[model samples]
Target: MNKVKVLVCGDVEGKFQTLFSRVENINKGHGVFDLLLCVGNFFGDTDEGLEPYRNGKLTVPIPTYILGPCSAVQVALYPHISGCELCPNLTYLGKRGLFTSSSGLKLAYVSGIEAESDTLSHHTFTDKDIESVKNACLRGQTNFRGVDILITSSWPKDIMLGDKGCSVQIEPNGSWLLSWLAAQVKPHYHFSGQEGVYFERAPYRNHSFSGSTPEHATRFIALAKVGNTLKHKWLYAFSLAPIDQMSTTHLYQETTDQTDCPYTGKMLHPSLSMKQVRPSQFFYDMDSLTDEGNQRKKARKDNKQQHKRQPPKFDQESCWFCLASATVEKHLVISVGSESYLALAKGGMVPDHVLILPVGHHQSLSTLPDAVEEEIEKYPLRTSALKKYFKKQHKVPVFFERNYKTSHLQIQTVPIPHNMAGRLKRVFQENAEQDGLQLDELPHHTKLSQVAPPRTPYFYVELPSGDKLYHRVANNFPLQFGREVLASEELLDMADRADWRDCKATKEKETELAKAFRCAFEPFDFTL
Candidate 1:
């Protein structure tokens, strides 16, 4: 009742002999697993190996749970798409539904790849299958806690949200319906296959959710195909307590490296049934699209065509960073460029704390074209010249960017005492360690694009020596973490000044400070 041991494998693909032999050895050495769950394409290009199991010539050792057929040859092996005990200790999980074990382990699954058109074969699932699964999961705000495991034959779209250096593009091979289901169900562990590769992302926290506190972090694992030539990992093993029998702490234990949940957009409304939320629905609202563009995209996005993303241009009329914006404070401007600018931060923790930001509505550099991204990268390297500028004043600049729940990119620069320069990184590390946060220093010469790519959430910092530290942010990360660390006793000893609001200055004071900074920086200003 405390917990159940489980074994999971990627596409069995008619390699039953090879897969089970390993399972038998694992049981002998690592203790017996209660059940074996198989995903991806269960049959190989042919089913000659499976004929023995169908005719009782072979027996499955571990109690096995599997899905519907994925190919024409495998279709003859299943009795139907519904549940069935195909052979000794072998069970079919059926096409789609919630499956609960006697040990209280709950599993949800969707069989087969996504359909390309209105035509769906036995190896494909449709919008109706998704609706049926959603309704059967006991969606009573409380009873629908979450499943222990979720299985899918095809990997979900956008599963790469937390990984660095890439974004998952919607392609013919991926399943967006599965992605939507993952967001709604919030399973503890999501297992998928069929792409024939092995990838395991760091544990990620699901949204705080609909009228619920933050759920447990989810672990996603994509296993390789059985007996593949490339020698990828095809098997995974773990133990977990059933939700009903576990205490909150054990169920929700936070991992050191946590990432943003892949699905961050709004979900289908409760009032709208799956009938109302069509599978054809792709990207949600984009405010800038014209009526004609919206209509065309709404119809063809389901086709999975790759269209160039057009992030709305910066609006000087409403952008607070733009000089013409309604909220712009003219007195704080320090330097300007064609594509970037610098300004003194309001309510500064230190009098000279400043901000480096884009001149317009850019959200992430990773999303920009390569030419634009490269151009932006070159601009910051020039600021390294400021080292000599700050050296004259007996101080060094520490820059950090936290892109959590923010649109416009803002890099905050704080100048610490010159003697404290060497202690900067160590102090930040110690602060994070005190709070059980991880501060990973990047390898030497790691490019900015490799730091935090498009659609990923992160906290990044740059030391005076140009070393970079990164934290893959999780749910509820402290809003003023960098500020708090810098304000610690080892550094500034201004712990009480961590919150910027308490350290604000009046308009006249801010204006005077900006003028002074302008005078001091004008001689070495790169833009000037």
Candidate 2:
């Protein structure tokens, strides 16, 4: 119930008196607001406009945070390259990183604009700037349930994705970097400027969210430059109860204006300049598929077979999920086998959502040693220890695996309420049909080897009815499609809980969870 009041403004353009005067009046009317955020061009064409604050002639009213300057002249005004307080109550958020408030409001920001080249300057942000924000979400040290807010200088392209009634006056010439960043961070709210337009898109569900749509949908707002002659509204105000503090009912309440996500495929996120995109390291790997590359591949598919793409080299030392890696969340590991191990999934979709991983560096189920595959599928109960582990808790196991764009193989097993078993196939089928995909049902108790040969890129789901469904991923497959179906209204109805990154518990809580599972799954632990 920790509610924090926030006020956000568009480009200030160095109109100190006009912006602060309005802010002071609002503070007088509302008495006290927790913080103020300024986005876009904070400085204008002259140093004279900023001199009031430098000379103590103007005050910042509330705790104000601003992105780095937009022009070369403004850059000279900023003394600290790593972010620091310019004066009392005003702080610069630096080049890029995650900023957490005392009230537990997490804000991820990329300052300035998208850099065109590999330049090391604040006027524009490059791939490393955006990647730093992604790397900031590293787990194990602390638990995160997504950021409360995200700030950027420019609106993400197609920011009006789900908003059908988008105004013609406001053309969204935003950044693909911001679009890609928005999809990954999944912040509750996002604010930007730079187009000099005041428009708020209808709350749209982030790519990984489905069931409790309103709880996790991101509200994107772009405020106009302050004191523009056209009289566009450049200020917005809202109150937020941090995600970690809200109760389930309050957080998941459905909103009437929700829309499907606008970001999908490479058209929404065309590749920018980068040395390489390591699809193996990230979960939603789409960098490999450029708009041009996809078209060429499709054209070749019609004429003749396109040569198989050589899989990217797997880097074990930096792998986050590897048990021996320095970055692995060791607290989540439960049971270890010679060939395979059971670990509590980080940011799991459910309390019992777990991962079945090979101890060695196997990239997919097709590449596993025959003996190891046999042990995984044909243990003591003629089933997996994963299946037995969930059954002890009176939940049916729903196992899924993706081989499209990953370096390490992980079989995600999420437990379902016992009664929900019968509804699984129908729901999965309906979702696939909606996506124009047909799920090929394998024969009863079909083995993985029968459906997928060595090094085949496929995604398959094993339902609780002992029935299996498979999808051969040729091109443009949705990364979180399985999660979308499972968390849809017909099945678990946990759309809000679809993304694993939003479901992580505390480290101490995770340790206790592993210990409990290790005890209950002992009988099924063939490793023991």
TM-score of each: 0.50, 0.53
Q: What TM-score does candidate 2 get on C-alpha atoms?
A: 0.53
Q: Against the unseen true structure, what C-alpha lDDT does each candidate score?
A: 0.70, 0.71
Model 1: per-residue Cα lDDT at residue 71: 60
Q: In candidate 1, how many Å is residue 334 off?
A: 86
Candidate 1 Cα outliers beyond 4 Å, as residue runs: 55-57, 71-74, 139-141, 165-172, 266-528
Clashing pairs in 2: 210-495, 211-495, 212-496, 347-500
Query: For model 1, how does the per-residue alpha-carbon lDDT over 78-139 read when each residue is reduced to its tens digit?
Result: 76655578778888877776777878787989888877655546677766566445544432
Separate clash counts for every candidate: 1, 4
Give residue 148's lDDT in candidate 2 (0 to 100).
Answer: 84
Task: Give a tens-digit lDDT track for model 2, residues 285-403.
Answer: 21232223455566667556645544445555766666677767777777787777778776677666677887666777767888778655643232666667677777888888887
